[model samples]
Target chain A: AQSVAQPEDQVNVAEGNPLTVKCTYSVSGNPYLFWYVQYPNRGLQFLLKYITGDNLVKGSYGFEAEFNKSQTSFHLKKPSALVSDSALYFCAVKEGGNNRKLIWGLGTSLAVNP
Target chain B: EPEVTQTPSHQVTQMGQEVILRCVPISNHLYFYWYRQILGQKVEFLVSFYNNEISEKSEIFDDQFSVERPDGSNFTLKIRSTKLEDSAMYFCASSGRTSGNTIYFGEGSWLTVV
Candidate 1:
């Protein structure tokens, strides 16, 4: 079994400031974690993924997420936020082994203010 | 960049009518999946296909829903009879690796059952 939880429905951050979108997961085995962003009326775009090795993975548009094992978390982060970075973000997980189903988060709408 | 492309960006159908959503995944990908997102809801996994058969599916992928690799280049999702609750955005995704791989998504096909 696998699942993802994004506790926040929305997160607000000032432009040029740092931002974080929290994500937690539940999986019976090693988890393949991922982050994706969706703009209005657009399909989701892959941000980054954590398969193994490095705990910190860098992704598109200067986005990054850290894989924290003890906490069962993979939090998306950006050193400096931009107004254009505001969008709906989702966290997804696929349990290792033969589990092919990718469980997704409810999503978090990020708003960046200037 | 190569991408997963979906057809009929938007479709409107009456309740009880059948609807087929189409997608063309990246040329070399071997794994295919379908997911849906109702307006203001989390993205839900519907089904995943590999090796010419279904690899996994969620409870939401009832008998009313069917998927096929009808031809060489296209994958399709067919809903036997759409209901009001069926109105949502459908996404198609694909991945190349067999395990713990990153899946790329299409822009999506919006289905509105009236």
Candidate 2:
């Protein structure tokens, strides 16, 4: 079955340090990958998505993700972490074509300490 | 920027009672979706609505669940009889005319069943 995996349950980083949240996906066709973030008591917020073009896709809040087809990975990354970035991050994917439902990864809790 | 909107940011109900969650998708979006996240769990798709009908649904979207676009602006999800297991954060989302567009989500409605 098509699925997404966020291998890390939690990632910790010092403020201003680079941070990464790993994600890998398996699907039958071209994958449309996405990243979302949820702050406590708030709804999931769209971060970035990879549809076709450049492997490096930039999103809201200084976040970006690299889509690596060979590795079947689309990892979320930020050049510099902020305490405000501490939250739960999710990776989701849907196969290209008419598929409407998104296969989601168990979220990764990111804590950027000051 | 336009965004989806949901009502009753939080609701508490007794088991076996019916509950309706309301949403207002982005004005121009043609595709609507409902998803849920059990506390600390991966987001799960429940159903997708398009052209005034359900286009897709997950196994979790059983007979107990129903969706309607009840007019031009409001989309709703009705649970015929709520269960304790139904306690979750229900998100309402929408996308552009085509499936390739990004789905934007609303601040979810939290349902607490007792």
Candidate 3:
């Protein structure tokens, strides 16, 4: 079975400062990694994904992630934090072999201070 | 842009009551999925449907749960009998069913089993 881990329960950063939400995973064969953001009372919105490609993948809302296979990590990063970016972020992984299942991590709450 | 949509933003039901959550996936997507998130917990995959049949399911999706694409557009999750533990936000998602594809999510339906 595949699994994802989001070590932080919450992260705080000042507006205009860069921010990072870390994610790691364990799966068989290759891994399909993804990032998502959620606002209160809403569902998750896709941020980015890492398939078989270059290590670095860019995503929506000015965010990007680097797939480090050796580290088993796909961390979400933003150049600059915004007050509006405060929300819950989740990391997910799907089996890259023959399994068609997705495993998710407990979301990390992000707070951007003004 | 096209996205998955779930109805009944909130549904409150008594224990042992049957509830069917409805969803309409993206028009062009071929794979549909159901997931649930308990308060302060990780989002758990319930089931995955494709070609009008279940492609995959998790432990959480057992005899008590069933999914159906009753029509061309609507997909539904039926809970045979509700329990207090079932109270959570249920989200519907859809994807293009390609390798390493991205999945779009619905706003989610908050189900509270009293």
Candidate 4:
């Protein structure tokens, strides 16, 4: 089975400061991890994904995530935060192959304050 | 960038009424999926379709739920008889090939059962 855990229900950050939303996963084989953001009343927007190659994967809107195999973690990070970046963040994982479906985490609410 | 699109941004129906939610996936994508998020809950997978057939589905996708690719460009999810608990935001997603690919999500259709 594959699953992801977003330990924090909410994360607060000040504008211009770095932000981190933790995510950890469990999978039978190699994991394909993803980060998506959802603004109010909108659908989830893909942020980034970790498939293979480098440990650090950069994505849209200046966000990135580090895939740590040892820790079974794929934590989303932003070098600097913006008030507009505040949204609901979700972490999802899949055991790569014909699975076709992702195991999702309970979203973490991010609030960036100016 | 092309995107997946969903119809009926919002809908309200009485309990036990049948509801059909529609989606048009990215033209070039080969895999399609449906997921739902009840308020404050995780985004749960409903089903995945490829080659006009369901490749996978979650436990939440019970007998009450059925999916159809009625045409080359459209995918629909039908709820046989909606319950109050079925109220949720339904998201349609599509990917280029497999689970490892980055999937794009539609804005979602919000369903309210009375």
Question: What is the lDDT, from 0 to 100, of the residue A93 in candidate 4?
Answer: 93
TM-score of chain B of each: 0.97, 0.98, 0.98, 0.97
Ranking by DockQ: 4, 1, 2, 3
Candidate 4: where are CA atoms >4 Å away?
none
Model 3 C-alpha lDDT per residue in residues B3-104, reported as the tens digit of each score:
899988999999999999999999999989999999888899999998889998989998999999999999999999999999999999998868578989
What residue pairs are clashing in model 4? Answer: none
Which residue ranges in model 1 land beyond 4 Å of their true spot? none
lDDT of 3 at B25: 98
Per-candidate TM-score, chain A:
0.98, 0.99, 0.96, 0.98
RMSD of 3: 0.9
Query: Of the candidates numbered 3 and 4, which has the greater lDDT value?
Result: 4
| Deviating ranges (above 4 Å) for candidate 3 | none
lDDT of 1 by residue, B1-114 (tens): 999999999999999999999999999999999999999888898999988899888899999999999888899999999999999999999998668778999999999999
Query: What is the C-alpha lDDT profile of model 4 across B12-83, one tens digit per residue?
Result: 999999999999999999998999999988899999988888888888999999999888899999999999
User: Model 3 over residues A1-114: C-alpha lDDT tens digits?
Assistant: 578999999999999999999999999778999999998777899999998889999999999999999999999999999999999999999987545567899989999999
TM-score of each: 0.97, 0.98, 0.98, 0.98
Interface RMSD, one decimal, each candidate: 0.8, 0.8, 1.3, 0.9
In candidate 4, how many Å is residue B12 off? 0.2
Best by TM-score: 2
